[model samples]
Target chain A: MRGPDAHGRFGPFGGRYVPETLMNALIDLEQAFRQCIDDQSFQEDLHTLLEEYAGRPTSLHEASRLSDALGGARIWLKREDLLHTGAHKINNALGQGLLARRMGKRAIIAETGAGQHGVASATVAALLGLTCHVYMGEEDMRRQQLNVFRMQLLGAHVVPVTSGTRTLKDAGNEALRQWVAQVEHTAYMLGSAVGPHPYPMIVRAFQRIIGKETRQQFLARCNTLPDVLVACVGGGSNAIGFFDAFVDDASVQLIGVEAAGSGLDTDAHAATVSKGTPGVFQGSLSLVLQDRHGQVLPAHSISAGLDYPGIGPEHAYLHHINRAQYVAVTDDEAMHAVEVLARHEGIIAALETAHAVAYVLKCAPRMPRDAHIVLCVSGRGDKDVSTMMAYKEAHA
Target chain B: MNALHTTFAALRKQGTVACIPFVTVGDPDLEVTRALLPALAAAGAHVIELGVPYSDPLADGPVIQRATARALAHGTTIGDVLQLAQDTRIDGLDVPLVLFSYINPIMQYGINALIADAARSGISGLIVPDLPYEEAQDVRATARDHGIALIPLVAPTSHARIASIVAHADGFVYCVSSLGVTGERASFASEGFALIETVASLTDVPVCVGFGISAPEHVAQFSRCCDGIIVGSALVRTIEQHSEALLDRSRRVQATRDVAHFLRTLFSQSSGGAQ
Candidate 1:
């Protein structure tokens, strides 16, 4: 939504909190990034990689049956789940991996929560022939064991971080530690539009491709942009991916749905933007669940991907600037949306993406009958099927 | 003015380059480090880069990493280091005391709180190796408000980026001897001297060479080209290997004195004069 000037401050949210040893390296990276991203050759190379390798320009499908089932609003889904790696994360991972190659870095490091980003990064690393290391929390490693196996199969090293709470936050912290130590020859491909300065900026730049494509596709389909745009927010990558292109267009309503777990009133939620206060965590200023003494609070959610205690810094900026509306969807509603999509469309969506589906379902009845809405089907339900089945059985 | 400024001025008056020794505080024990600082300053060290222990020190070599592990195991912290400086009154010992560290521990300590505590403890400067100069605005501003210098570093590859780094650096510029992490090497390469000259040409601030500077010849070579010589891994190695000799209360004070004396002698001899 906003660009960082020469200083890396996005309304005082995105300043660099890196160590001094890596200052020169960061400066070198900044300079190289400025020149390379602008060069036509670099752009062409990135486009070629996206098209030939990762399959660019994923389709936007209109869900007529699902819309008829709702009987309130017209619904369309931008099928990022159809993309390679079954999510929108490959776009950012490829961009960062290419940038690393251009910077002469031999290795890439990344952190994963639900392991979608890890799989995406590992895929890119395998294709690019760069050494890749993905740090995952011990708890996440256990929960997302399939993705962990997939990453390993792709020839990437998966290190399970056990410190802190042994979750996404701890994985991110461990990755940061590893990056600081080896900043000279290594590049940390942060998974989301989060972290400090250039990361939020860079990750968003990579993810903006999704929004760019969505704008053109939506315009082509409806002869205008959708009335409302919705996406799920874990670290807010997919939400920001679609929202970035629409921020300046005030007429296009951007709604970001966060996982509310059991309920927002309960501790079992990841509704940071809706319920938390502003603070610095993982090198960026954002709304985080913290105690009065500023200690980070434990976060919870039915979906492992949406279990983070904080949203991305750029999301915080967007919320502050009133450019986007952030809402929360409870666990029950999300499960219902999963079943609705599966029964109506024969497409089971990831639990994280179900949050967006749930939000639209809840809001659709209140909107005009002919209102057009676009929801980002951010990932597939295949990886999350086991968890979804368990939740359904428990509820039954 | 901060003690760092005073120390530089004093060194200039004596026509001598500053000898800054870096050591992880409480490497062997907190009590031993509490007794080591004053002895180091009294021996001839113009400035002290007192390292605060971090769990993961990526840029550090084997020697410093072991030292950090030891210090952290001993429960060394930013507050503990600051308390040592305050309790021993070593911060008032004329030599500038710069807190050397990675950023996470400092961020965990709270940037504002660390600056305030450091100022109260009479810390003269901060040298955060992991904090880039471009990102040091808030840290530099806080240090300046408290009259402490926020010294930034420049690596060998810091050619085109010199102007920005020079603009941000205070007290002095720490010129890394090589591209890799801190550790001992058999010989100092010509590239280190070239880097020293390059850094010196970019800024008027004193250029102190460190990283891989372990032996007398390395110090001698730096003495001929730069304004200061910093020995980290070598001293860390000495402490690690000779802990009993260095930590014995009767010999602990003398160990730092001997190292500082050795560094000063190497510098003076290389300059073809006596200090």
Candidate 2:
């Protein structure tokens, strides 16, 4: 298993691009992660928390009716949507919450996009009796108000960030800024497979269980690996979690679907891997949407979760090496996929996850009958009801 | 010594603190930025930091973020900011000027091109808030080739790594006053002083204290500990609040005067060089 090299380079992406104030914190976190990865007690504790607290070993569901409607490849869903807090974010949150406790940190600071990560972080912090503070963009606060209230109900302080774009990126800026002041006692529970070195590495490791389960469950049922693996990409935590387990299997083609708000041909989209160039943003060197002079361009997407200008560095590396193929699904297509799943398979996915579903809906119809595909249902659409209502109202 | 080293050395010889002021370029307007550079230099700023506006500035606090937004609102590109630096040079601005940009903007400008242009613009040094040692190797090489100083910043958390960061790194070391972005603070920890003192003791390169440097007392205190102090958010806030009414008119000289007077008062106390 070729892990990130000592310097934390994942094929020209992922490095410690951070303020010096947090540099040592990252090193400390990385050391803690490495130590705990091998400690039997730590492993058992995390495993127990995943099972007993976050309700892990999320089921792998065969969307038989939906697959039959598509009329081609057999489609399956890795039900992270069924995880506690209704998203895969809980997996990493619980793991990092444990790491923070191990490091003796009493406070956990996190940034949230769609509020799912915030709720997950707050859930773990509440469960462990740690002081929790989540920074969420003002724009996101409006888009995902329920999640904000959920975070607050969990006894976490939700700070509304009104900085640039007032979205995920801005929320991160505020979180990092606040972290600088309290690095002594706080652990930044970064919510995605992004940010500086050990964060992407750490988040990806915690999320690996998603794919690990999918692979095992698929093997138990279908007797072989799926021919194609699909997941949505934002900061790409859930995708990387699912993709990492299947990365080495050459026969399994990894597909990452990006949020295309309107269309990739237009400016309004978060198709970072498709449209972005290599640059440093937030923390890591990765594919980011930037103008000619290098100022980061705010990404727009109907789904707040996927509305970010940069993708995870590992995903960038994956796209660069042709290990994973990235495609864009417009808001209309994704919404349609949501409706299709809700009607046929009794699954209502987050708008972010619907992008992957949209892609499978289009592609499955043309694939061979026996072909199998595992799609990551990253989160439940309960948090996205407002967005769905607005779309319906606008269209009606 | 490079221009940064030479500037710090001269300040050290004078036994005075180098009062460095930072302002976002093209905030309100570039014409004002062009004028403010020399005004700040004449007003006791030993070195000037011209902030390049970026969409996302993680290392900054609210004041600088607003300043950046104002500058970016005016569509001030890095190239435009560099042109203003060149204009200041033509205006015979004598103080050492540095470009303070986030890595994304510099990467977009192309690292080598940005370095070459900075050298052309008579820029003395570069401070990338996000570019620490582990990831700065690429731009650091080109900056070295251009004789441009790549100022290294060491935070208090960077305890054991300080010696190595200061050893191979060029330019004066920036000692972050406390854990946080740039903003005024009531007081800093004693550990901050100890960190700066340790960094100062380790190398020939000068150590400068920055972040939360708002008060003149901070200048006097940090002056005793290191080679200099950086005054950013306070100066930026003054310009942002005062320059709004005078933006379209040259009467905005009030903002410049406000900045100059603020620095004058701050440094006048620091001339005693700490208690």
Using lDDT as the measure, which candidate wins?
Answer: 2
lDDT of 1 by residue, B196-255 (tens): 788778777777888877666666667777777787888777667657867787777667
Model 2 C-alpha lDDT per residue in residues A1-396, reported as the tens digit of each score: 445778777888888778888988888999999999889999999999999887889999999999999899999999999999999999999999999999999999999999999999999999999999999999999999999999999999999998889999899888988998899899999999999889999999999999999999999998999999999999999999999989999999999999988998999999998999999888888999888888888899999999999999999999888999999999999999999999999999999999999999999999998999899999999999999999999999
lDDT of each: 0.80, 0.89
Q: What's the C-alpha lDDT at position A99 in model 2?
A: 95
Q: What is residue A174's positional error in candidate 2, in angstroms?
A: 1.2
Clash pairs of candidate 2?
A180-B179
Which ten contiguous residues of candidate 1 chain B have the minimum total lDDT?
Answer: B266-275
Off by over 4 Å in 1: A20-53, A64-72, A98-107, A129-131, A159-188, A259-311, A329-340, A386-396, B8-85, B90-95, B100-117, B129-131, B137-142, B177-194, B200-204, B209-275
Candidate 1 lands at a TM-score of 0.76
Worst 10 residues of 2 chain A by lDDT: A1-10
lDDT of 1 at A225: 74
lDDT by residue for model 1 (A32-122), tens: 7788779898899899988887778888898989888778778989989987898889989988898999988889999999899999999
Clash count, one per candidate: 8, 1
Quote each prediction's TM-score: 0.76, 0.98
